[model samples]
Target chain A: MSDLTAPGFPGEAVRLRARTGAAAAFPPAAEYGQVLFGAQCGTPGDQLDAMRLVPPVFMPQRLAKLIDLGREPLYQDVELGTVIGGFSSPLPVYVSALGSTRAAGGDLGLALSRQAGALGIPMVIGENVVPVNGYGRLDEDAGRSLLGRLRAYTEHLGDGPDGGVAVQQSTEDADAEVWNLVYSDPAARPLLDSGRLAFELKVGQGAKPGLGGMTVVDAEAAARMAGQYGLDPVFGEGRVLRSSSPGTFTAEILRQQIRLMRNNFPKARVWVKLIPGRDVAEAVRVAVEAGADAVTVDGAEGGTGWAPSAFTGQVGLPLAECLRRIGEKPPCLLVSGRIWEGGRAVKSLALGATAVGLGRAALLAVAEDQQDGLIRFVECLSMEMRLIVSALGKYAPGEISPDDVWSP
Target chain B: MIEDGPTQPGDPRAHLSSPATRSTLRIQNQLLAAAREYLTSAGFTEMLPPVIGPVTDPGGRGSKQVDIDFYGHRYKLMTSAILYKQASLLAFDKIFCIAPNVRLEPLETANTSRHLAEFHQLDVEVAGASREQIIQLVEDLVVHMVQRTIAALPEEFAALGRDVDAFADLVQGMFARTTHAEAVADLHAVGHDQSADAEIDWAGEALLSSKSSRPFFVTDYPKGSRGFYDRESRTEAGVLRNFDLIAPEGFGELCSGSERTNDYAEIITRMRETGENPQKYRWYLELVKEGIPASAGFGIGVERLTRYVAGLDAVWQANAFPKLPGVVSP
Candidate 1:
């Protein structure tokens, strides 16, 4: 390195020094490692295997037109900020649907692990599994199977040089019984340790704050979930399911899960993701107090795979307020919703967030083209990030601060 | 003077005289044309967004709610044009819109001097530019609009005994840039510490006594006090890339604007912490996904602007059918 007192490059040196300071402030890279698994809805075995070689592969749903091919091609031109996976927030049954088909050349877990290892992107599997219906009852078997599969899948994937898998969990039933299985599963330990596997305790999503999620529990799936909950399968098709049980008691169950994860996998990061709402601060306080390592906030503008018209269009909070409240907490803040570019990411970081996830933007890349599309998306976001930092007279992601923002 | 009297109900033209109304309509038309020309010359295109939104986002402060039935679904009416700001960030690089907005204020008084339930706002936004460029554009547009309007109102100016040239000069002079800190310091220099935690009776009394020119920009607001999207000055303290065009009249603030937040992660965190879900805004986020060029924009309150120009004390006087407290009929 050049002399620290160099005239022409002192600014550069100072910037480099500041970047080093920021890196020091950041938790160890492995501590923040997130393993995102792309459980492509009905992805083919051959295509899934192909993803294993890529650094980090984001799998979009297998289109109806391509499902019969037994080889789904990844979008090749999408960028980093593009949204992947389902447009609407995924439901538990949705994951169940993928899981049921995973046996038939759709092993979402193996694909996620392989693609994560290949692309060098952390693995986070969006498992929209719920264990309850609109009527109070637990879908034990479905919950157990989903959790078991996730645990097994992460373990099978093992930890790369970086870390393990991060499971994005959306539970329908918040009872202790349901969480007990999720927390106590034997396979979850190793994945949680080595910082490979983690848990995302989802409360309300940005697309539908305070609105319960619905699962089109098919006859067979309904029977499985109902049997686990000890309920007679008397209800017909399209049974609506609420995620949280009676009162705020469900929060306790999440707390227990956090404790269990920490105790079992001391290095694993636990995050609680909630939609922006009137009561977000209180909710975040609960999550933090509940022993969460970080909190992920989703704004009303967040994309969902499918949601009620009212919930998607009329409910929840916007991103700005979410950042303001979450800023109060310095923990690892992973935010999602409609994040598209580097400037947006920089803005969030400045306002006090560790990182942001590209759900819709990621999906859009895959939907528009394939893996190339996804790569293009990431490139576009990275370029934007660099440009924004340069314009703000800063270098690197760490130097960007909230002081750089203002209202016109 | 005509006595205030009750008129027959449900009659559209019952209270109007054709000759007077015709002249008023003609003048309003002329004013609208002048304003439109000024904005168009400034390179702003007219655009519109869905008036009914899912929730009130961060930029929406002091906004009103309207109930509208959309294809069997009922939705609230928009209180301001801020919603269009985000939409404009997506579809158009630079755009403006003149539209009606509704708000529900429970504190209903019969004064009709400073309040209105429904009004029009001349909402303008520009992207892909810097803060300095936007300020210059706004100044030019305001000057153009005022010049044209005054030129067309020779009879009114003469009747009011107002010096048209002096008025024009005053408007032009106020455009000279000044910082908020400087303004506050000037106020303090006059022997009043307006910074006191308690209300400064002397400061308020002095300001009320002053006959300052109407229409000027208040630049460089405190960073912590500004909205989430504003860009803070790179080289100043307590100053954001923000400006408020205030009119010396009942219409206190005519326009409020600032540069937007361009950092992806910061934007996300702000949205989430504020209880806003980014999932609903996939398209909006895409604009910034690759990064956004430096830009700034502002919304000019149409009713307030018109009220200032027309010398109307109440906002209701500027609207065709003003909605005020407890007044159901137009």
Candidate 2:
């Protein structure tokens, strides 16, 4: 059949031709996979836990694997229905998470990307990519360097036909597509096509929201990312100021990231993760408006390796309430918290989440056994899902809708 | 008593202007002084912790509605003096504090005099001690406060025409020792049918229903039934090293005391099992790790005690700014 008149074709005459041909062949629901990949990394195992809580002075190849997990084939699988990639640490290591000052030094983004690639998982990255004066300070030069490193990694993954990286700039500074474009260049297109590139606009993290991120601004690294993203150069150990709290910087940053992603790779889906709070609905609305393909609502119950007790316990809304409110929107929603049992994940989906992310549980699995442990954890969750489904007389994960939920 | 005027129902201005029959301000001040002195003599340093905590770290029980700005930050009022108790353990070996605790009560009934929206507690904590020490301290303090009250209000007691002999006999009788088994046997001896398979609540009811005189201590509780922090008794019965100071009339339990757990590893394990983060309480764990001496502590319901002493029916009568049901302060 001609490409134009072929079944499932996008162009004109495709509808007319369908009337003369038999129904297109499609696989049974049970035959298809529902998992997707974003990046790769080591399973949170005993080995990692046993590693002294010290900073990584010298970057390890394993760190690179983590970053790769956040790249193409890994993230592509996450977008498609195969095996869902667990998004681990992609941001700079904080003192709390690492437990030492040395591990705080290395290229955190690169390390995370490589890890994601190794694990064949798509990881979320870049919350406060910009530098702030007091918090996560980054100069124009540092920003440029960091963007350059990201661009180099994306290019290495191979983006377009020429095998040369493609660079698409956003129309406006606040456009979300700006970061997406940078990640979807010709050099990175290969990874994007493979669903390894899962672009995200991080509105709020599990840590303090009003406060920006903190990263040791290496001039060389900052220049790389800055140059790649078309920002001015940064210099020295001086900190960079990104945005201030009670400000519109978060919304602006999200818009820019979305605009960039759409301009570069329209096929790839984008996500925005936010902490649940009293104004969660409003935040979700903002994310949706910024052109997020999906939204993740991280509840106060969600665990982080390190965060102030006050922020960890008091800052965010509960996952159930957040999901219930955000589910009003049509976008795919992912919820995180004490989602251990299958009932919990199913309950989350039933409450309006398209999926649920497990941080501590996943870490526990990895810490206990490594990759095998993580796989086992997932299996346990899947089995739990199956049992719950059978009990409810439902089949697919999508079948576990809000209709199955009941508030206590 | 029967003045006739236009019946302005529920009008504040039209109500009887007669003076309060029970002027308790002076008595209340004197009682507070006496309680503080007694606590101090027991080696408790006075302290005060922040009234506001992160909305999320509500020590225990249900979630609280915290006041926040447009950004959704939450600041909850202190629910209890437990935080201060925990903090004071770090500095003073023995400490005590009197503070107001607030909580929203949906089921407020006329008979619910014990459960108030807000109440006061004379919270105390002691480290480096034993269950016996806690019992002695609580018993002595209770007696001392009662004695002080009697001495200060001879005229009032005389006016009420209450027999001092009855009060003295009641005080002396409570100082006597009685085990849980003995208490149970006493109840049965008095024709209160208590089965061996009965729950603690059933036993508690049997004891409360008995025509026991004055105040007494209910000791040797089952370890599994009490909070995880309570120390288990070393005796054969495996009971918890805890006791409740029960009073006669309307006052049920005026004080709860126990020897706290000092084992760091066990405390962490228990906390983890309960799904509470041990990291958040790192400071508290440090104390146990440093090998703090085994101590016993107890908290007295200041409001309950005052209410009993003043012959007041409700706890609100003891509190200066009482938060009553259906009443919102400006």
Best by lDDT: 1
Interface RMSD of each: 19.3, 24.4
* Candidate 2 interface RMSD (Å): 24.4
**What clash count goes with each model?**
131, 130
State the RMSD for candidate 1. Answer: 25.4
Q: Say which docking band candidate 1 falls in.
A: incorrect
Residue-wise C-alpha lDDT for candidate 2, range A141-193, written one tens digit per residue: 33223244344344433222211111211112112223422342343445455
lDDT of 2 by residue, B46-81 (tens): 987567654222222111233334344324566565
Q: DockQ (Cα-based) per candidate?
A: 0.01, 0.00
Q: For candidate 1, what's the TM-score of chain A, rounded to 2 decimals? A: 0.57
TM-score of the second chain of model 2 compared to its true counterpart: 0.73
What are the TM values for chain B, all candidates? 0.74, 0.73
Compute the lDDT of residue B229 as modeled in candidate 2: 61
